[model samples]
Target: MKDLPADARPREKLLARGAAALSDTELLALLLRTGTAGRGVLQMAHELLAAPVDGGFGGISGLLHAGAEDLKRIKGMGGSSKRAQLVAVMELARRAIGQQLKEREVFSSPGAVKQYLQLHLAAKPHEVFAVLFLDAQNRLIAMEELFRGTLTQTSVYPREVVQRALQREAASVVLAHNHPSGTVQPSRADEALTQTLKAALALVDVRVLDHVIVAQGNALSMAEKGLI
Candidate 1:
């Protein structure tokens, strides 16, 4: 490896120093672990950089769903190397998504909550329901995934929601769910569920801020529409 050119070497330097000391290509090479028949891991890293799909070629979250087979189709990626790269990318994305929410007012207004939820949940292919817990000042305390299911229903337990809020010591909360069909209109069930959950939470001194429905590129607020 010492005989290789500067760009062709990464792992050795990374081990000698630290990951933060390496460039983007070097980092990618580390993730890749090995190269194709003619290309080295570092070389493949450069290729990925030049053709980044979403955030960048090496954008962690962008490649979360990409398989090793897909990586193999690239010019300089092979079976083992591709698998390693894909796994590394997925782990990076998971860590990034699991990061703690910053200390900010998560939902001071209905519009703010709708905008924030739309960034991720709206584009998902399946249903995801989230509950955002806030304090008296409307600062975010916690955001929890309440349910995951199909278009029709998700097992929403009002008691569990109330319990979680009390555990977090939140003074207010907002409910959010997505519709994969790209329509932001609230269904009858959505309305009914929001009402039921709101009534339940009120007993515990936690105010329901709004119930937001997110779809492709659009979001609707129940409070804004006089529903909540």
Candidate 2:
């Protein structure tokens, strides 16, 4: 890094150009700070973002879905403090998005909802059924993981979803879940469950805004796909 011209450095380039101008590796290098004896920080960053075959998370989004053990597999992430820092930063990202939803209408930024759900659920080893309760203005009231099941499927009860919505006094809700199998495509059973929940909620004057399916680095909005 020192041999590289001052202006060419990540910190310098970021200062001159802006964070968005930096590549994924450059952004990561800024966080990583330094590398081991033989490897440089930039090289370490490159390795960290490399494909699974190369012992990396594959990309920034993939890293977001990585857990403590996953971080342990990386070369420079062995230290407890570094792992803790990465975990804390990821949690902050989730909280920041949650705050944004709380302040504005949820659908006003549909992508945010997908990102929020991914941050919360995509890393799981098993399936999870969760819901976002929203007020009349469509702002998020609360999000809850109501059920958990096997890798392939989850046994969700409409009655429980309805009860939670009532407890939150929500006017509308968004259903979401993760496919640990890395598929964002909604199954027939997923569609059936959405319809079942929609009808049950409608009985109590609650609206089903959308159902989002999340996987590593991808998300599908059922409403966007005309499924909801």
Task: Highest TM-score: give the candidate number.
Answer: 2
* For every candidate, C-alpha RMSD to the true structure in Å: 7.5, 2.0
lDDT per residue, candidate 2, 65-184, as tens digits?
777777988887898876776777777888999999999999889989999999888867789889999999999999999988852224788888899999999999999999989999
Q: Candidate 1: where are CA atoms >4 Å away?
A: 1-104, 107-111, 151-154
The 10-residue segment of model 2 with minimum total lDDT is 149-158
Q: After superposition, how far is residue 219 of candidate 1 from its true place, in Å?
A: 1.2
lDDT of each: 0.71, 0.88
Instruction: Report the CA-based lDDT of candidate 2 relative to the real structure.
Output: 0.88
lDDT of 1: 0.71
In model 2, where do residues sit more than 4 Å from their true spots? Answer: 150-154
All candidates' TM-scores? 0.57, 0.91
Tell me the tens digit of each residue's lDDT in model 1 across 96-214.
43332334465434455665676546656689989988888777776787788863334788988999999999999989999988788999989889988899999999999888898
Can you list the residue pairs that collide in candidate 2? none
